[model samples]
Target: MRIIAIGDIHMAADAVTRIPEIGSADLVIINGDLTNFGGTDDAKRVLDTVMTANPSVLAQFGNLDKPEVNDYLEDLGINLHKQARLLRHRLCLIGIGGSNKTPFATPSEFSETELAAFIEHAYEQARASIDLTEPVEKIKIPTIFVSHTPPFGTAVDRLASGTHVGSSAVLSFIEERQPALCICGHIHEAAGTDHIGRTPICNPGMLSKGGWVEITVNDTTVQATLHDRI
Candidate 1:
């Protein structure tokens, strides 16, 4: 499967026009930040543009997006926050939107414990009827996790001050679960790749700057490429 992962749009509609390079993707995953403190209408406009660009869109609301945007996306059946869906190739996609609390006090903020609980709940929701006795490594189908905040101390969450302002809970989850892939974006300055144990993590950066991540998954492999428009 070919998936285009993008986030941190910050209301730059022009970025949508430059995504033809995402060509023929089976799915388009919008990590978060569809708007910059905008309302539901703005979220709709962004989502509409994305839907027109790619019919298969799974999105979540970011810290910059108003809480109502979540409902709007849900009403449209494009919301992925705390949700999961099956994709082609026996792949499962699970999403957790929002972020850990920041000094800025964004619209969506969660404590470490809250974030961990949210993840656990979401995982349960994702695996509903499936037997989970088998180790995650033994599962035939691969699962991909999408989050707004990068895991702690990763290359993708470093601040300008050189601080790693990522989520400890996210890091712990990655270390423990080791999902096939974890795609995240919240720190634009840290648009890059990192790893926790055997799992690969990616932060595609802000769409407003024409940055995105392209992922290709096959029976035995999953690869990600970071793209930045000049």
Candidate 2:
């Protein structure tokens, strides 16, 4: 399947207007940070704009997102996932919103311990619900994880201080489960793709400044491409 993913929109109406022409992909995934300031009104505008642009849009909340903002997106039919779910044509997607705790204490801040627990819980729940013995054709599909924070030490997460601010818990989870893909964005500068074991981890960067990432996946292979709008 062809998937176009982007993040960090930060409430840019121009970028939203340009999105439909980006490509006619089978699916569109918005990583996070849908607003400049996470207010209900701002979130409403962002959600309305995006839904109008793409009917197949899948999104999650960012660090700046408030509960009202999340509720608004959910009301507009965006999948705000703290867990995984299947989408168009059996594409499995999991979304975790927010980032590791920062000094500023943003809306989406989660301590490393809390984040790890959350991921672990989600994985266990998914594992319990699936029947592995069933044929792949008959059984539940595998998932591609989507989050706002990248896993630690990948090329997609190198900060300006030369530090890796990604989540070790996320890295561990991917190493264990090996999802089809991991798409994320929080650090604007660290926009690219790398692998955790067999799964590809991608950070599509920010959309407000006109950046995005595209990925193609089928039954067997996956590839990613990054682009910057002029």
Candidate 3:
């Protein structure tokens, strides 16, 4: 399967108009930040733009998106926040929205413990359909975890001041769960990839700034590429 990942557009809903230029894919995953404190109307506008690209889309709201916007996205059946869906029989996609606490106290910030609990809950939801008899390593299905914040200490979480401002809880979850891919954003300046064990993590950066990640997944391998476009 091919996936196009976009990040942190932050109110520039019009940017989706150019998504097709980046490439074609089976799915488009909007990692987060579709709006800047936007409401249902704004979310709808963004979704409309995404539809223009004519691909199946899944999205999670970023810290900058208002909580109510989730309602709109849910109504449209494109919200991936705190939910999981089968991309194929052997692949599942899970998502967690919002971000860990920051100094600025963004409206969607969560404490470390809170974030950890949320991750655990979401994981359980993701695996609910699987047979409990199967061992963790024995399960053939690959999982993709989508979050709005990168894990702590990764290249994608670095700030201009050289600080790694990501979620330690997310870090812990990735280390333990070891999903096939962890896609994130929110730290726009540090758009890149990092590894937690065998898993690959990506921050596609700010979509409004022409950044995106293209991914290709097959039975034996997964490829994620970061890009800078105009």
Candidate 4:
């Protein structure tokens, strides 16, 4: 599967078409902040614009998006907020929307515990939906966690001030479960990749700024590449 991950859109709907492989990618995952506290109408506009380029899309609403936008995404049947889905036959996908409690108190901020629960529940959902009856090695399906916030203490979470403002709960989860990939965003300046144990973490920054992550998943490998602008 070829996947494209983008975040912090902030209403730059036209930018989706700017991606080099937007139309051809197997899947497009919008990490969050599709609008600036915008409602369903605004969400619809942005999502529709992306659909123009690629119809296959899964998304989560970030802190900057209005709380009700979650329901709007759910209605669209492309919501990945605190949810999981099977990716072809190669991977399991899970995600959590919103950021861990921020000082600005954004509309979709979540407590650390709540964020932890969200990912855990989503993982369980994914596991329950799949039949894991193969051999031990065959049962290990590669996983992707599309989170809105980068995990704590990673290169993708550092800001200009040098503080790691990501979620410790998320960090702990990654350390424990070690998903094959974690595509995160919200900290715009930290548009890069990092690692937790063997799990690769990526922050694609803001889509409006032309940041994204390209992922190619096959039976042998799941490769995520950082794109500063594409």
Candidate 5:
């Protein structure tokens, strides 16, 4: 599966247009922060641009997003998986939204404990809902987790204070349930890739500033490339 992943578009529709076509992949995952203010209109505009790309879109709402904004995206047929999904024959994708509590207390800010609880709930929901009769093992699939907040201690999560303010809860979750890949983008400056356990964790950074990650997944391996648009 070829999956192009980006995040923190912040309502920059042109960034979506700039995504290079991948003839090999089966889907696209927009990690979050699709709007500047989580306004319904902004979400709709972003949804329209994504749909035009003509690939399956897996998305979640960022802290800037309002409830109505997410609803609007759902109405437009964008798959909003706060939990998880199995895509094609080889990919299992999961999403978590918002970020650890920030000073601003934005619409998407959550405490570390709160974020952990949400992630746990999502994982339980996925386990309960997924059919086990399928040939591929759910746990063994090339699972990719999406979150608006980066995991702690990654290059893609360094704050202006030089603090790595990523979610420790997220890091714990990944440690407990190691997935094939993890993608995130909330700390714009920390826009890059690294590893957590066996999983390849990536923060495609802020698309509005022209950063994105390209991923190719097959039965044997997964490869990711990070790029910045000039």
Candidate 6:
């Protein structure tokens, strides 16, 4: 499976849609920030544009987006927020939308406990989806944790001002569970890659800046290639 993941769009559909990989990839994962303090209508505009190129879109709303946007995305059957869904080739996507509370007071911000709960909930959902008859080791599905907030203390969560503003909850979960991959965004300038143990993490930055991650998965092996702006 070839997946093109973009983040922090902030309504800049053209910047990301123009990328040639969008039309050809098996899936397009919109990390977050589909709107700028806007509602579902704004998200619709952005999602509609991306779908025009490729309709296989899985999205999560960011702190900048309204909470109600979740329902809208769910209605469309393309929402990945707080969800664990199976994709082709036994690939499972575990998603957590929104971000931890910030001083700026974003619309969809949640507390640390809430974020942690969301992560566990999504992971359990994925675990439940697989057949339990096989041994746990034998049925290890390739999983990707897509969180809007990057994990704390990683390069992807640091600010230009040198402050680490990532989610400690996310950090803890990643440390313990160690999913196949952690794809994140929210800190736009901190567009880079990092790792916790063997799990690779990628923050694709803002789509307005043309940052994206190309992931190719073959069985349990997942390779993520980060693409920065042109």
Clashes of each: 0, 1, 0, 0, 3, 0
- Model 6, 1-230: lDDT tens digits are 89999879888887866786678899999988899998999999999888998998999899999987888999999888888888863788989999998999999999999998888788777767764554222465777889999999999999999999999999998888787889999999899999999889999898878798999998788889998863
For each candidate, the alpha-carbon lDDT, in order, equals 0.84, 0.73, 0.81, 0.87, 0.76, 0.88
Q: Report the C-alpha lDDT of model 3 over 57-172, residue by residue, as the tens digit.
A: 88888888888877777888988887877767767787888898888867677788987887777677766756555533347778888989899998989999999999998899
Ranking by TM-score: 6, 4, 1, 3, 5, 2
The whole-model C-alpha lDDT of candidate 2 against the native structure comes to 0.73
**Best-first order by lDDT:** 6, 4, 1, 3, 5, 2
- lDDT per residue (tens digit) for residues 98-191 in model 1: 8998999888788989889878877776676345666444577788889999999989999988999999988998898888899999999998
Global CA lDDT computed for model 6: 0.88
Kindly list the per-residue Cα lDDT of model 5 for residues 96-169, writing each as its tens digit: 88888877777868889888888877676556555564322244566677888999987778987789889998
Model 6 misplacement above 4 A: 133-138
Report the number of backbone clashes for model 5: 3
Q: What is the number of residue pairs that collide in model 1?
A: 0
* Cα deviation of 209, candidate 2, in Å: 2.7
Give candidate 2's TM-score.
Answer: 0.85
Q: Candidate 4's residue-wise lDDT over 180-229, tens digit each?
A: 88999999988888899999898988887889888998885789988887
Candidate 3 structure lDDT: 0.81
In Å, residue 67's CA in model 3 sits off its true spot by 0.6
Tell me the tens digit of each residue's lDDT in model 2 across 132-170.
Answer: 544222344657788788998888888888788888878
Question: TM-scores of the models, in the given order?
Answer: 0.94, 0.85, 0.93, 0.95, 0.89, 0.95
Error of model 2, residue 114, in angstroms: 2.0
Clashing pairs in 2: 1-217
Task: Please give the lDDT score for candidate 4.
Answer: 0.87
